[model samples]
Target: MSNYKFILSGGGTGGHIYPAISIANELKSRFPEAQFLFVGAKDRMEMEKVPEAGYEIKGLWISGIQRRLSLKNFVFPFKLIDSFLKAGKIVKQFKPTMVIGTGGYASAPLVKVASAKGVKCVIQEQNSYPGIANKFLAGKAEKIFVAYDGLERFFPKNKIIKTGNPVRQDILNVSANVEEALEYFQLNKNKKVLLVLGGSLGARAINKLIEKELNFFAENNIQVIWQCGKLYYEEYKKYENKNIKVLAFLNKMNLAYTAADVIISRAGAGTVSELCIVGKPVIFIPSPNVAEDHQTKNAKALSGRNAAVLVKEVSLDSRFEKEFKSIITSETRQKELSKNIKKLALPHATKHIVDEIEKILKTL
Candidate 1:
């Protein structure tokens, strides 16, 4: 018999998927007899990533509600009804002792149905500004785990616990391993490396900015570990050359973090969590395309504390080089960011989050 069973929900983006995975992994590690079942939006990355990580997952027919007037909005009611029914089935079949959400489009249905059944429900929100689904689940959640402070504005203050975000354990455990990292990327140790990520799909503006500055990077004696992402890879593949490694997806992000001195990243919650552990100087280019401009909010939280830098997407054409140059060249500035941001690192975050889970389980 299993010691415990859990139903974990979150997806639609790496930010949500990763934190859920970290918690699941930690739970499994601590309680080897634990059974975990993940629920994510159908067709999202978690459907594949979770299984690969050695967990079972079920897909729900949930998708984000369209903000614009579109045909997609017509199906919202039906999808919600269908997803909630399916979530109820998953929970009943699994007989979960607890349910947890990391926050995404898929989280709402899972947490709502589980909590309605009187199971212990918890949500881990990995941002300063919580997403709609997490905010929706906040009141019902027995505990709300957050990475940023002052999030009581979104959730029930009495219920919130600041546990920080869970990052991959390997990243926290990894040291410079400069030689091994260089070999992983097949990069030269003599050159300074700049790692650029616009996330899994690539941001158009960051891609174009990099194209414009490609020659400049080569000229500046800098090398690049660029993850252009799948959607934009075809358009930018021709620019691939020596000293520039371009990937549609970076499977070895831990090495990418170790190899780079400066990071140009979209300030997604997951990216920010990883960066705090990586503790490199960063230039955040918040995608103006997100639901609430939360990326900028995340970046500002770091920069406001003198922990990082921000360059708005619209301002990138003019300011990318200048800001990047200033941060990379200043040893003093890099040291400060590294030290201050490391203050935000949740190195044992997975452990702490799982500890809370055990606390809830023990109360029963």
Candidate 2:
């Protein structure tokens, strides 16, 4: 039993929360004796998700700084101070050996406090372009694990480690039975499937565009596997047709990925990592609601390499079908995209991140 404790902080969205939990799970697997704790914003998704993932979590009063001057901005300083103090108290009580921040508003205060306490601290940055919190803590962070390059523009070169993004193991195991997957979704065997995803809560812009062009699939005789997300499922559920399967969520993403001919998605970092592992041709519709426009940057990294197509939110309705047809209809384009995106997969991201932690322990 390794008698060490670690603190993990990340929240607000699933992109930030899931990666933090994945790394925590890896560490716990490697050192079952180590105690772990997660810190997240009080009302954020992580408050529920981290606990459901079978870990203890503390809530912070912290939230992201508003782009425009809102009433919330007036209390931002107080919230930061309170969160910092609370995180400091938690660190003191826990006496953790290491602290890991996965990049969200709550992570900033917790990791900052831990670093000040001289605890070994690291951060996992999921995107090519990092959030304001990650960028703020870059210098203080003992090491920085990033999913892409040019982060040196934001973080120190000496501290940055390119470990890529961690995804659910099941998602990578899509190499299993394609016939079974098609049957599981009850999808047509002959029709090319177009899987549309917009993260967990969902994207309104993506939802509206798909609703506006609902007939496009029938017109083209294309099969659709749409993960409408929880927020929009009730509104969009009525549009379900023989050629379309609308799901609020799918536990068997491996089946969904295996059955899809082309993917239409919001380009969150974790999703990009999973898509790369699934090796499917993708059209990225980066959500504009996220901080720092990180999703767009993440999409650009692949689209810039000709590995995927990028459809901006504003241009989605006009360009989605054209781009969709090009990829879905052309086997050559699909093959090229699959091969190119696979080059970016890091199936063993957890292994590398764990190795870095061990290296830190040895140096001590």
Candidate 3:
């Protein structure tokens, strides 16, 4: 059992990939002799990121179907068939004791093939609304780890386990790093800090909203740490100054969380989970472009509980400043938000997930 081999399949975005890495890392800490192999889509970030985390990864020629009809859509069936064959080969060769899918189209083929061949499958879903891949794989999954309630609508009631999303280890200790985090960001202690995140690739709508509000922020005496994303960096970098720190991406996310007094962010499930741990006052502007508007759902799950504020992208022009001003100007409001969000933090989520993984490992 100590020498068990595990296959983890998920990718497409940081939300999916990072959770897989976190789970694998926790499993490794517990069972040093365990073997792990990551399976991701070819040409995706996971191919680069997983290896950087000291794990071996294989890439399948797979991509999600494009909503609009195109040449890629026409070849979708071929890609699906190719992925199935390659995934079956990998499962046959690896002979993993268990396969875990963290929800991406790339994960479906591998998880499907492995389960069919009698390998146990586990699904970790990050969103309040499960993705097509996880939904399709639900019946076959032995256990479905989820962050939100009400997922029984999509998954089997008996199979669901309400373990929150696994967050970066750094996030669990962010409070201890505040002084160093402020120095790392080179910010003034006297001024309020507003941290803005548009996710890893960046969100066009968020960047535009930030750009339009630069003057407003300065007038309100708030300094900014804006992670505008790589795609939008060039356009937004010109706005950076002594008061405005614009980063294409944040390598030290824990530090960013530590330094901020208030946060404005996209509500990707992974980001929301980390934010809850950060426990700062937050204004969540979910990306409207994602699948099933799940980002909005992720945000509402918190805002509904009064843990964070949710503002739809469509209403940013009308409500952004009002929402931002309310949180920034009111100390009591900030404390209440921070306190409430912290109440929702599952600091031991990684351990809880691995505990479940251990239970399954025993069964195997």
Sorted by TM-score (best first), the order is: 2, 3, 1
Q: What is the lDDT of residue 266 in candidate 2?
A: 90
Looking at model 3, report the run of 10 residues with the lowest lDDT sum. 170-179
**Two-way TM-score contest, 2 vs 3, winner:** 2
Each model's lDDT? 0.88, 0.88, 0.91
lDDT of 1 by residue, 206-251 (tens): 8888888988888788899889989999988887777888889988
**Every model's TM-score:** 0.94, 0.97, 0.96
Best by lDDT: 3
Give one digit per residue, the lDDT tens place, for model 3 in 264-331. 99899998998998899999988888899999999999999999999998898999999889988899
Error of 1 at 222 (Å): 1.5
Candidate 1 minimal-lDDT segment of 10 residues: 168-177
**Model 1, global lDDT:** 0.88
- Candidate with better TM-score, 1 vs 2: 2
Where model 2 places Cα greater than 4 Å from the true spot, the runs are none
Higher lDDT: candidate 2 or 3? Answer: 3
TM-score of 3: 0.96
